[model samples]
Target: MIRTIPKPKKSKRHFLWLLGMKLMISSLLIFFFMSSCTKEGTISLNNTNDNIGAEIADSITVRTATYQLDPLPANGKGIMLVGEMTDEATGNLKASSYFRIGNSAISSVTLPDDAVFDSISLALPYQGYYYGDTSLTQSFTLHQVTEEIKLIDESNAWEEDEKPVFGSGSTLFTNNTFRYDTNPLGAISFKPKPTSKTDTVFVKLNQMFGEDLWTKVKSGSNQVTNSEEFLEYIKGFVLIPSGKTPALTAFPTDSILMNIYYSYTRTADGKKVQENLQMKVDDTTHQFNSLQIDRSQSLLSALKPDAEGELSSDQTKQQVMLQGLSGLVTKIQFPYLHEFVNRNDVIINKAELTIETPPSSHTPYTAPSTLNIMLADEHGVPKSLLTASYETTTQAAYLVNDLSGGTRNSTYTFNLTEYVSNYRGAMEDTKSSLYLTIPVSDLLTKADRLLIAKSDDSLPIKLRILYTKY
Candidate 1:
């Protein structure tokens, strides 16, 4: 030992100092190697909550790092990660969520210690790394290592007035409105009835002449002489049965008949005056088969002495006498024995009368008159079998010249006499309509049959009045 070169001045401080320097150099080399290896491999950082409070560690480990891709890389494309680490590294790292490198699609990466990253980023770098080779890429860091989190409440986010309520099993919403329910019982009921008033007037005239030889007048006065006197005139006569003698009483009470006649006499002015002078009973056809008195009997014979004398004095005197006697004589005569059969069952066939007056008086004066009889049952209803007909006659000269210069010289008549006959056997209903039609041919036939002269011409009528139920 004595011979070991004298151990020149060995000290503790120098030995410790040499040891500290050797340790510092070894640590620096290891750190540099680690940083270079990290760059070659893939640097990853945890963007999760744990990184929020983390200081700059020697390395970085990503547990929840989502990426913000500026221009997302297409499918099958490789993405690159780039940022400065806490260790002061600035090169990009090959790592992505949608794409991966060989054997590290979901692998964990370790970064070098002492790395400080300023702007970290990721992107799709190569093609054919994503499905369909799409161009989607994560190009930026979606979260920072230090960040604060926030929570939101979605309740009451929408206004109450704008919100809608949905019923069970229904997606439709309803608003505020009123609806009504309608059913059969909600319908209204209405009924109609007759509420109109009826206005009508009826008239009946009865006449009597004498007790034993009584005659009832069928036709009423042409004009009302005086309202009081006219009423008395209608009731002046009483009806009586004719004598039983065969020759004296040829007219039977059960038969329906009519009579018509006219006469002419010379007036003081030398004018021939004509008028309805006598009436002779016959069948309903109105034919003059029987006379009230024999035609040969003098009409003056029945007049008073003064009247007879005046009539026999001269032709002119006779005309004056007849004219004055017309008012006293009844134009229509019916014996009391010829009473309407079944008085209670009798029906008024019709009760219409029309008069035609001359606009100006002239020679061959012609005035027309019409009467319609409508037979009805005891209840004032029409009967089917009761019929009636009309006959019109004019003076020969009037027929030849006055009426259209003989163009309308024939007759104008109607046959409605059979419309009501058997009056007792009719329906009881009062609501019945009886239509009366005077066909053109039927009218012409009656006109021809009752024409004053047998001419080959037809007459035109001036007026027609009809009475029937509508």
Candidate 2:
């Protein structure tokens, strides 16, 4: 999917920019040398002037393209994401989660002989993470997973380094899927109150389904005797989004609960009593989301993931895309860095990369709180995270919101002084580039997306540098 470009011919404007920079540096050097000349026309090389340093330049050229990476490993992320949303730039995306149910008390469920089963319900607690238009009601179906929700073959899971951090023993990616019963056990439709801590969405399961489980426990069958036996009897569940859900919502795995309701006869008091059997998520390491992105109807439709994966900003309305769930990422290349290296007289002091989004694009969906920059090889494969100076932690570009009740000044900035200083040597690999992406944790778990304007837009991406002449 990766292609290399030949060195492009410099345009007239590029030539002029370099010429102007050289002239400014030459003027400064001449002024300093002339001032240090002695009476006999001998120049004094010793100079201790602290004020003569670092000039700022914000005109460096940055080329951008939308690049697609391989599917991300997504199992056991603490949260479960589900729903579907249509995006104008990257097309439609749908998210679904698969999880198993287990309870240590299943074996000890000793219901009264006179107890009668009622119904069952599944409850999901919100994690407050949302994307797309939330004004409309959201809907999805709950299906019983017919097949065991276990990892694919361990040997085929992932590269050793790319294994899921929370997987039980193997790994699962966004591309992995499990089979579920054709008929839904339950379904739900409601307006989401993601911010309300106490608000929860519940789906009432079919009476027959609840009765079957209750009957097993009441009869003391081996299927309901122990947690391991229970898993074999009922594999798991999958939350499948309806065709036109307005937004994607998130739920914490630890808070998901399923309950079976029933009424029992109290012989001593001659009264009826109510009781319920509760089930919680069995293994957090086995829970995962299955994400599908359909870019067929958007500008990204032209991207070919297996061969020639890059879609230039020029072809995308002068904008690049950054999305989570391994959908798309923006690749950046410095086409004019050679001009700075050729002079060799100036030392790079500071370099900042500024990225902006058009205010008009901001709708109910907001940008991600942070983005990551990664170093890529000649083949466009991510190599390592770009980190802060003298630190192992990855350097992230934090979103700076526009405070005027409008998103006019929204931007993300990164300090690339170290990177720009060594860009000359990095040029050895002609196709080396930097990728702007969401954090790995979010990329594998959330559905957030962002659009970055290119150089032709009103608020285009820019790389500003501060240099000091020797």
Candidate 3:
């Protein structure tokens, strides 16, 4: 048997009577609270910069996950010999980059008839950047590319959000290694007092190899006649670390020249005229930096696309990781944030997010210099957060001096007042998650990562909100 439902008709008089009752009740309530009203029917808002006597306040721990970003720029920032590091949160990271430089001379590339190769030195100017411990001496190997290190033409340039693929071109070179102390072992003199971020370094290359190149130039070889032939003859340079240093990054550009020093006896006299031919470095030096991360050793390495507990109620498996060039970020979500859904009359005085690291995490490890909290898509691409007004004005982090030496100052507290206030009705649209990552800098950024505190951690992550329920 089938049953049919009937529609009931509404009367205009009954509707008018119900609306009148509601207005009367509202008027009476307004009159009762008139003493506390700023407007005829609205309560007055008291603003408190700090959390003071909050009428409605609560805290919650959100879920977090690591998000791997796209491939970093191939050769723009500089050279890299990133040492390996393994942590429970950030996984394993090892970045090694390759670069290709060409002859600077336009034409008339010549050598003295009696010029005898004395020595050659690779001079590298500093980029004012370095990572890892300077306590240990490090070694970086230089290789010659057997294949052309061509530039990515605009036609072949990857999309803005596209991650690049890793390429290991067949490069040829005799063994050339640079071994040096990262720090001065004895007294050092500098006209400007060379800082850790500045100064130049030199590595002596094989003189025999330098002579071989000079021989080719004098033999009328195509390699010395033209830039294209030179690039084809001596493809490019690549840096390979010995893996002894914890981590290291070096910036090498065309200015990082190979100076060929030789002496030629003048035909007029028995005098020796010493001249140095410098390999040119200019805008034509096409370069790229590539990062390789081995997640096999990472504690969060097992996370999968369909992994459960990513944002679980218990919060054991969820984690937030941020690394600059390594291309990783963390996604976050406060499931219960809807509790503050439509607080139209409330004033969000303060909303601070405190993230604490576990005891198991490495201490004294240099954290990311800066960070950003923004909305993210399913692909982990970041978007602007209209509510994160203070994200720019506020400092990314502060020094929590632990002079007393306890757990009081080990946490990273981010001011999220403007961000939380922007989300007054944002939940309806952002039903999925937000993200935490290093500020994007058009790939000019460096290698840095931070591991946020998870729920299972001793301190865990908490979002403390202090608002006035006017």
Summarize candidate 1's per-residue lDDT along 322-390 as a digit string, tens digits: 110011110111112113312452322322111121223111212222222223233222232223333
Point out the worst 10-residue segment of candidate 1 by lDDT: 84-93
Task: List the candidate numbers ranked by TM-score, top first.
Answer: 2, 3, 1
TM-scores of the candidates are 0.13, 0.83, 0.70
Q: Each model's C-alpha lDDT? A: 0.20, 0.78, 0.53
Which of 2 and 3 is ahead in lDDT? 2
Candidate 3 is scored at a TM of 0.70
Error of 3 at 323 (Å): 2.1
Error of 3 at 144 (Å): 1.0
lDDT of 2 by residue, 71-117 (tens): 66678888889999887887888889999888655678777888898
Model 3 lDDT tens row, 198-311: 566566765666788777755767776777787667666655554445555455564567677878988888898998877755433355554445555555555432112233
What is the clash count of model 3?
7
